[model samples]
Target: MTTEEIRAEARGQAEAHLRALVGSDSAVLRDDQWSAIEALAVDSRRALVVQRTGWGKSAVYFVATLLLRSRGAGPTVIVSPLLALMRNQIAAAERAGIRAVTINSTNIEQWQPINDAINAGEVDVLLVSPERLNNPGFRDEVMPRLAATCGLLVVDEAHCISDWGHDFRPDYRRIRTLLADLPPGIPVLATTATANARVTADVAEQLVSATGEQEVLVLRGSLDRESLRLGVVRLRTAEMRLAWLADHLAEQPGSGIVYCLTVAATQEVAAFLRDRGHEVAAYSGQTDPTERAALESALVEGRVKALVATSALGMGFDASLGFVINLGAPQSPVAYYQQVGRAGRGTDDATVVLLPQLEDRDIWAYFASLAFPPEQLVRQTLEVLAQAPGSMSTVALETYVELSRNRLETLLKVLDVDGAVRRVKGGWVATGEPWSYDADRYARVAQARQREQDAMLDYLDTDRCRMRFLRDQLDDPDATDCGRCDNCGGLTLSSSVTEAAVDEAGAALSRPGVAIEPRKMWPTALANLGLDLKGKIGDGPVEGRAIARLTDLGHGQALRALFRADAVDGPVPPPLASALLTVMKDWAGDWTDRPVAIVGVESASRPQLVGDLATGLSRVMQIPVVGRFAIVDASVAPGQGAANSAQRVAAIHRRFRLEADVPAGPVLLVDDLVVSGWTLTVAGVALREAGATAVLPLTLGTQT
Candidate 1:
């Protein structure tokens, strides 16, 4: 056959495959789509695709996998980041006649079978989560073989690999190690819809093989989502935002998402919306894997009005959601854009709105605090690891170090990258390699975060086109005024809330009391810290109640104001006092008996507030203000040396003493805030030892 005829025949087959895959008769491939597939399947070259969401990025990879397999290539290895994304990819691959299987935390039982299938060449594509890249079994047994023999390697949500990316994860950094182990000349593909120019370039660079003999083809596309009608509805208070959403959600085009900054807010907003007669659900990292899948399916099938969520539902959601409303702005515009991108994908029009809150910066700071551990702490961890002769389980190390569980795990991953430690069968072992904490790199990252924060703020305040501002933040060369947005098109959301609606929202917000789940067990490995504590906290305090969470949308603002460092320590505000009474009345009726007296935890900073809360509650409930738990030493202040459970228990171990005779019956213990719950635990212990029959703890708020 002639060369031109052969080329035409190949293109014909590719087009026919696309038609069958999309179930469309006129499924002509875009130039960029064809280019990406040609690079991966024909030229056998690495490629990085930076396109908008719903732009057929998955089609490129699926088609490439099919074509590569047709030529007798082995199964493709896709390092996906989320279970939802993996599920969607597997379904799409199956539709294209590319059999796909996944190995993720949600499906361990299928691993052996999937591995067997891969060995037998029965699976054309295998999807694994980014975190699985470090799983002991997968990393040591499966990854090396896949690296050597997999037909193609694809990194979905590739921006996650770059620290500069808004949603950067330490787990994704393991990809570089995976890339290094890949045999040369294996065509690789990295794809993401959120990367700006810097992140795109950074990720593209990582696609290079260990030997650096091959080049990566960069394909960039405009990020403007024509279907998204972007806008910001600035409300004076969080209650107003909730009221507005409750009033307007029914007016949105289709079932959508209500994004929140914290898990607490997700549930709170979902509840508020439900009370307003809307069908909604809450989704977050806390959601169970099976439940998360169900929730995703519900949203996809339009069974719920919306899913109030955190970033856990931010990415990997494949539904063509019709609207996305942000209850509070994300810290970065890139992050915001990626989230809003979830809407209007398959539809012709979708609404995207951001309701920026004053508390967003505080939430941002709280999360950022966990970003990179301090050099001193990192070194302390390394020193401990080096001294240990054998692998140290994370639980074992937590007792020695003071970081929280998640933070500690993140630090360990970073250390592994720096060669200070290695993950083995039992746990992690020290490599004893000389490693310097990358102070400059961390500082740069911190600065980048601050810059992103500033950019987000600018996005909110800019009178220019909203979409244009976002596009510019992403370094999109074709960024122009998206006429669909509020700024450019003179569109504005109705911030109007009826008086009745406002009153209802205010009542909902003012209604206080969150169940403070008592600590049932002591942190693992606390004995290793020489504290002599182990297992369940046998006589630990029972379930307690707090007036509200500091992150709550309604009472949260008032509580935050009262807790502010600059606020004068005084009596509990009348509104909070009223809320406390309601909380007490609404307290679980299962309490065997009413409290006999009020005992306040002494606070150096909020002495007046804590004292007044105890006195005020005593007067209202007619219970005696028996006595205060005197600070034995007052040397270790609350929250000092309380980063982790062991340290927290140690700090407050003997810190409190019952000042006088305890009440014979249940005693109502009070505090300004329940941060670690250790204070309450130790104080309850002291009371129980002193003679109280039972303790029912009450607090103004619970820290996030």
Candidate 2:
């Protein structure tokens, strides 16, 4: 047979397989989708498919898997990003008679059996998280075998592999290494619904192998989603936003999503909507895995009105969702487009709304601050690993460095990519690869992020069609105004909120007293840092209270203003002071012992605020203001780089001296903010040793 005749036969088989998978006899593959399958199955070439969501990207893989497996090739390996995505893929694969198995954080016990099944050819496809690729045991033990035998490799959500992508993940960078290690001539496919030209180019260039510069079949498609009717609802305040959602959420055509910018907002909005008689639930990274699965299922089955969520719900969750409403804007237009694509996937028309707020920029800035740590800290971490001979767990390394757990994890992934460190079962070990900080690359990535933010702002304020602005931001070559958007046709979405609803929302947010759990143990690394502390803290402070998190919905705005970088540090304002009284009342139930004196932790930045808070607490509770703890040497005080427990404890210890005599009763410790909680732990230990019966730590706000 001629080459074209063979290709035609393969295409026929693939379409038959696809039709069977979707359970519809009329189902047919689009031409571009068929091209992707042909490239992967017959041509055996690397491919990158940049198509909009619900465009049969999954079909390309499932059909290719069927063709490849029929040729007696090994099972396909899919690097998926989210558990929700994995769950959806597994179900879809089963429908196609393809046996799909996953090894993720939620199912560790099944790893051994799954590994055995893969080895025995019982599983047709294996789905693993990007983080799993770099895990110590998986990387060392199973990855080599899988890389050698896997018939095809699929990277779902390939945009994450690019540093310039809207949601760049460090772990995803390890895919380049995996690609380089794959056996020769194995077809590789990467797919994403959200990559622009820049991101698409970045990701495509990274699809390399031992063969060197493999030709990637770049399949680009138009990104316009015709079913979505996009609009924006601008609100003057957070309360009004919540009220509008409560009043109008049920009016959406079907069960949908309501996106929030933070976990605190998720909780607050979910509660408020529930109070207004909507069946809703809060979904974020904080939700348990079982609960998240149930929530996803509920949304799919139309059992709930919406899942009030953060970006945790973003990635590859598959449903015929009918609408999406953003309570606050995402920082990037590309990200906004990806999220709104979730709606109108299965219907002719679905609503997509963005309620923009000035506060959203602050939230965006807080997240942006979590970008790659400075070069000094990176070098310091590398030096620590180099000096140590055996593998050191991240916990052990925390003794010598100051980065937080999440930040440290991110940094370690980068170092792993640079060959500066190796993660093992015991922990991480120095690779002795002589790595240098890529300052220019990091700077370029930062600049790219700023541009994305500016584009998002432009999207909010544009006089043109919202859909067109989004498409242009994504470098969609066929971008044009969609007559469906509010800007194009002037739909009647009101900014006005009912007074009764606004008042109820205000009351809900005003409810005070977010719990402040006490630190039960000192950082285990403290002993390694020459501190005499180890194990559980014997005299740790009792469970305390914070008026609110700086990220909370109601009191958060005021606290954030007070803590702004340029805001003048002064005494606690009248509004925050009044809120504290309510917090005190709410916390009264938890206090077993009432008689106490107040003690303030001296602050170099906010001396007046800390001092005034202590004094006010003393007056309101009728307890005496004992005294303040003064820094013996403010010059040596810990810097912001000391974000971990051990570093924070080491930096702040012995710097503060107790100025007042210890009272015989319980002591209330006051501070402006609580982050690592180490400062409070050390101060409480000192107060206890100084003969105080109990120490209760209180703060105006707690960093989440």
Question: Top model by TM-score, which number?
Answer: 2
**Cα-based lDDT for every prediction:** 0.87, 0.88
What is the lDDT, from 0 to 100, of the residue 246 in candidate 1?
Answer: 83
Question: Please, what are the lDDT tens digits per residue for candidate 1 over residues 92-206?
Answer: 8778787889998878899899999999999988999888988888889999999888999999999999998998888898888988887777899999999988898899898
lDDT of 2 by residue, 561-639 (tens): 9988698988899988888889888777777788478888999888889989998888889999887767887777545
Highest lDDT model number: 2
Point out where model 2 deviates above 4 Å: 638-642
Per-prediction TM-score:
0.97, 0.98
For residue 335, model 1's alpha carbon misses the true position, in angstroms, by: 0.4
